[model samples]
Target: MSYRELIFTVPAEIAEPLGDALLELGALSVTVEDAAAGGYDENPLYGEPGLSPEVQAWDRSAVTALFNPEIDHSGEANFIPELLASLKESDFHLAQPSEKIVEEQDWVRLTQSQFAPIQIGKRIWVVPSWHEKPTDPNAICLAVDPGLAFGTGSHPTTHLCLLWLEQNGDLENKSLLDYGCGSGILAIAAAKLGCNPVVGTDIDPQAMVAARSNAEINHTLIQFILPNEDAPELAADTKYDIVMANILANPLQVLAPALVNKMRVGGRIVLSGVLARQADEVIATYSQWLKLSVWQESEGWVCLHGELLSAISNEQSNPSHIESIATPQKKRLKLVLLSLFFLVLLVFAEHLSRNSLLPTLATRIDGTSSPIAVSAFSLLQKTDEILCRSLRCINRSVSDFTAWKINSASLAQESSGEPLKIPANQSKLQVEIQNRLAIPVLFPYLELTLTDAEESEIKTIQFSPQEWLPISWQDSHPLFLLRGAPSGESIHSELAFVMPQNTAGYRVRIFYSH
Candidate 1:
């Protein structure tokens, strides 16, 4: 069977009334859209959370009404004339409607065909229920269909967040909280990827309904609740290994403390739905509790990632511990200043001696050097020498052995120091690794593999950060190496070790500890 689609160009005041009139005049359905759509002055309505536009219809509206021509009540050969007469009788002075014959088809198949399987990251494949089979059967298929709620895995913000979750392969049995979870897609994905005891919370009660339904359809054990619900997992004391909030920048900044409180110490946080321009402000807002950096950006949107290295709270947040460390740092500063003062005084004292005589000589009679005068002169010279020696020693001892900053003359030397002097039993290996990722991570282990001419591994040695990093650096900035390398930066290390015989080739590799 075929149906007739009538399109009428009507003004804002008449659009809604015309649609209602058409429905009463044997029209099967009616949908109104903007007449100037796809043109220069095209207008679109956007209703953000808790807000909506004043009028639902556009200034110039295109009202489309579907009618079954065969079931016309007037028994006329043509239904257009009869429908127009009825609308005119009802005081809807609409223009002559344009007509189109639409052939009936299986709408379910047609609608489902438009949404193919989307592969996200490595392990996730968002498959609709009607898809029947996925392109990659081994992929962790998410049985999600387009719904009224957000997060269908098609938008860039949702895609980037899903990509992060999919690529993270170490989520086994980790607790997760999907804050501001819409449709519970993230919570469901995390649960499928081995995140146990997952909880999803949103302020909207309808979101909880959609989240629960989606979780049930995916066969994942998840707890979906409103933010104020009496759930143990969402209590004030509860903390999660991973806290994901794919919310906007403004809300994220406002809820920074609340979200940080949800994370356990050393736990990771994933954020999304932030514009590229707004990324910096959001990062700075969260930096107080933890360091947040842009993990990835897509279509002018960015996903931020960070780890909560320390516990953060509103009341205390360990201020006493911070002051304790600050006290020692202040003492060190005072010691440095005192050392500089002593060095300056030593220089002044040496100037007074003038390389010939001390103040004691000026007090001597007949310009002759006495025993007491000589003793005082020697004591002043000795004190100056001691201060010079002690300060220089301190400076040299505290200097960076491998600071790797500033261009160096030694950097010109190749890895193999002088090909002629390449040691047979012992060799020096230099390794430099650059972090290509956007976010910083903990320092990785450097692995050196020794191979013979046949490419078989003759021997290998794994160097932990402690082995390759300078001892002074590790002692001074212990948390830096523990946190990770700076984003898109390089680290250099040189090692001298005993080499096994028949070592003709070598390979260098770097990776995080675990």
Candidate 2:
């Protein structure tokens, strides 16, 4: 319902008591803000790691109290006089009060009205669940909803980060790490844009839960984890192609070392959730490990992008030295080294492809002439055909083959199983696979071992997406990708595998590589 709002500018010492007195005088709710906000006299209060909580309130307070309009027919004319007289008798003086009518609103609709499809760059859009997907066929729309976490793409900080992501171009086949991943927006966007193996870490379990839920909604695969004291040790073991952190300045400054250590040399780091005035302090904090500069600014928020500097020394150095090392010659040298590294990987993959060890072993298996073995071989051949067609290339000739492999480990390692529907008369068992991994797997072949009631091995057969596609009637895009298992982001294609009717149970083992 509509209400009246009474506002008073009071000294910090009197603000709390005045608010309490208003509540006792029938105010529904009372809140305080800095009277000088957004002005030359503004005072911004920030809480640091070791600071006491008592210092949180503003120095000069604008106390606002909400009251039912019917309580005082004359508005402030009656209530303000009564309130001032009571305070004075108590030896507490309050300045002149102001009143305004607050119109009643449909709060739910009002909140929803404040959010709409937010476009980032030319290719990406953040869409709320209630809205229709963007009509732009090329637009990468992320279905996000407001949740308990921090991000909704409405905040200026989030906007800045998303803009950076869009301007950076295709993240396809790259690994990304999202630190302080509230709502998992950035990580999900990266996954949609083709970044393989996106990892999102947050200190709040609620945020982690929200992030995972958002990823699932977007049909993107992202690994969300809670980072604790031992996070540094785990972070040191892995390196990312890009690292993004959209958190406040203090935490960002404190995390500089850890974030830098987790990035590959020359890899890019994107940071946001910082005010324009606080940019210099954050830049100075990270300058030790990365050469940082303001990349973009929007609505008073700034995004900083930087490249990890060479790891030539353990001690901290000046920003000038970091800048010096990021010169064109050094960048070229780094690029050359990276190219050679990938070249070695390609050669290694080629060797594996040429060996054809798995096929040879399958062909030589005992009882290959038997019907079960023959059927298994047929399934394997069919899977190979589907992979070649859908993945575009089965051999190392495809550059993405190596990238797929590198990005595979980034997918969620957890596996879940469920029974697939089948005819009651058929002596075959069908199982469905939920490939939670971030990168697509090529020709995911599963080996199933049939067992009798006595739990003794009876017969074995293999099944893959090709065999499951016709039986399961699933979409062909994800299963038949010539590139391998398509990235299981929004829709994880369930590949059905058929097994010889099991009198008892069976064991499953999946085999595939990028």
Measured by lDDT, the strongest candidate is: 1
lDDT of 1 by residue, 298-380 (tens): 99999999999876644446666788678879999999999999978766766554333332232222222356655665576
Can you write out model 2's per-residue Cα lDDT over 306-403, one digit (the tens) per residue?
A: 98767635433776666665686788999999999986775445344632532342332222134655666556555555555655543421212212
What's model 1's TM-score?
0.54
> For model 1, how big is the CA root-mean-square deviation?
28.2
Q: How accurate is candidate 2 locally (lDDT)?
A: 0.67
TM-score of each: 0.54, 0.54
* Ten-residue region with minimum lDDT total, candidate 2: 405-414
The C-alpha lDDT values of all candidates are 0.72, 0.67
How many pairs collide in each candidate, listed in order?
A: 2, 14
Off by over 4 Å in 1: 10-18, 36-41, 58-60, 72-93, 132-138, 203-210, 213-217, 247-257, 275-291, 314-514
Q: Give the TM-score of candidate 2.
A: 0.54
